[model samples]
Target: MIIVITRPDFFEGEAAKIAQLLQSGRADLVHIRKPRASQSEVEQLLFSIPTELYSRLVLHDHHSLAIKYGLRGVHLNSRNPEPPAGWSGAVSISCHTLSELSECRRKPYAYMSLSPIFDSISKRGYRSAFSADDIAAARSQGLIDERVMALGGITFDKITEIKEMGFGGAMILGDAWR
Candidate 1:
């Protein structure tokens, strides 16, 4: 199912609302992508979530913390090559190009996100380099995985179209909850 990983700056102080949204099935996965949050902030937010909902939540760039907080998994940035040795859990990575996609395939992570399908308001200075058709072509070539998600500039209105383009799901920002 398509998921919405909340960008912290936008979803600040809305963890409960976010949790409620996820719990109510408005989103499949709620990945907390807060780059500047302190450990305490993360801990507080995680603690606010009900355990029964843990299976559908993920943290970003904080693998150890996610484990400590009893979260489901983490979404790695492109910079991290692999999760620490002996770690056994669901781990996802962000990949923006075909080469990155090829590299992530060799890793043992559970899934990956191919992003900036369109210029995103959240990432103001960046522009999308690939068209949805380009992504579709790559998928057709069997370069991406069935678990791949299309991120950047995605909105609730675009979910159907993104799914139609063969993406397993979408990662959105600055849309509904912005």
Candidate 2:
């Protein structure tokens, strides 16, 4: 489960890059997380990508596009915490704490992201919130499992440690864009 998160804002040739990542199997899913973009802007970006690969795309905003384009899923975030009404497709949420993860596990979701596992590279002051002891305790209690993805400050080099920590995958942002 190599899940990559798109940059917050669209960049030149961004769609092409996303198409390549999915087409080449570099990412199992790519979450399109433009918090401030217009619906038309997001639509244009989606149009640029090949229709055959739509199943690998997950919209973080303008979730209507997911249904309109038959995309893989919609991501739940602060901007769009609740999924679209009556949406039964693949749904994923973000959880910053093990408690949140534990609570959210009752719902049927495809996966969830645990963030700030390390000091963030994208957000200047977002330091890690969990210590080794905390993570170990969570893992021992069956909190950090395969359904969880490690987000924030994730890079290719840290994948081994992430896997060892029992994460299903890593959701890279700054390192990916850089």
Candidate 3:
């Protein structure tokens, strides 16, 4: 489960190419996290990608488009903490703390992202709140497990560490773009 998250701001000429390449490669899931994008904007972006790869896409906004376009699922964040009624396909969420991860695990989501596992490569000044020891302890205590995917600042080199920490996978953002 190697996941790739889209940059918040769309890169006019490069985003589609990168996304297609990622989908064709090892990314098991691709979270489309354009928060400021309108429905039309999102649609346009989706249109750019090949229809055959739509099943790998997970929407961070305009979730209704998931069904319309046959996307993978919808990702729940602070802005939208729950799935809209009638959403029956795969779902995912963002958890910033151990407690939130614990709570979200009880739900039937495909997976969840435990963010800031390392200092953010995309967002300046967003550092990890959990230490290596903390993650180890959490894994020992069963707090971190197969359903938890490490997010934030995850480069190719950090995947092994994240797996060792008991995360199901790594959700890449900046590293993929860079």
Candidate 4:
């Protein structure tokens, strides 16, 4: 299960690219993370993609769009910490620290993303927060398991290590859109 996160800003042909990813099976899920876009703008983007693939796309903002379009899920971030009222479908969240990851164990989330495992390509100077030793230790302690995904700076080259470290999947942002 490889999840692809969209860029922060929208660009021409972006919807087509997202559709291609889903249609080609290149991404099991595509997270639309446009934080500043208007609801209408996001709807326009959604209208461009095939309706059948809506279930493979998750929204970072305008979660109403997710419910309206029957999207895959909603991603919780600092901007939107809770799912929409009565949202009962698949839900995921971002966790930046190991403690946050550990704390998420009791939640009923579909999965949780633990990020900054490597230097970020999309955000300059956003370096990795966890060392390999820390990751190994977390795995041995049963904190990193099949419900966790490695996000930030993920690329084709690191998928094997991510799997070996006990992550269920890799959440790709900078690497996938590049």
Highest TM-score against the true fold, candidate: 4
Q: Tell how far residue 27 is off in model 3, in angstroms.
A: 1.4
Q: For each predicted model, how many residue pairs clash, with residues at least 3 apart or on different chains?
A: 0, 0, 0, 0
Please give, for residues 32-127, the per-residue lDDT of candidate 2 as tens digits: 988989999999999999999899889999999998899999999888888888677899999998889998888898999998999999999999
Ranking by lDDT: 4, 2, 3, 1
Taken over the whole model, the C-alpha lDDT of each candidate is 0.75, 0.89, 0.86, 0.90
Better-scoring candidate (lDDT), 1 or 3: 3
Q: Which of 1 and 4 is ahead in TM-score?
A: 4
Off by over 4 Å in 2: none
RMSD of each candidate relative to the true structure: 2.1, 1.1, 1.4, 0.9
Per-residue alpha-carbon lDDT of model 3 for 27-52, expressed as tens digits?
Answer: 87788889998999999988888788
lDDT of 4 by residue, 1-178 (tens): 7899999898999989998988888789999998999999999999999999998889999999898888889999888989999797899999999999988877998999998988988999999999999999999999899999998889967889889889999999888778
Q: Which ten residues in a row have the lowest lDDT in candidate 4?
A: 152-161
Residue 44 Cα positional deviation in candidate 2, in Å, after optimal superposition:
0.7
Q: Distance from true position, residue 47, model 1, in Å?
A: 1.5
Residue 176, model 1: Cα distance from true site in angstroms: 4.1
Candidate 3: where are CA atoms >4 Å away?
Answer: none
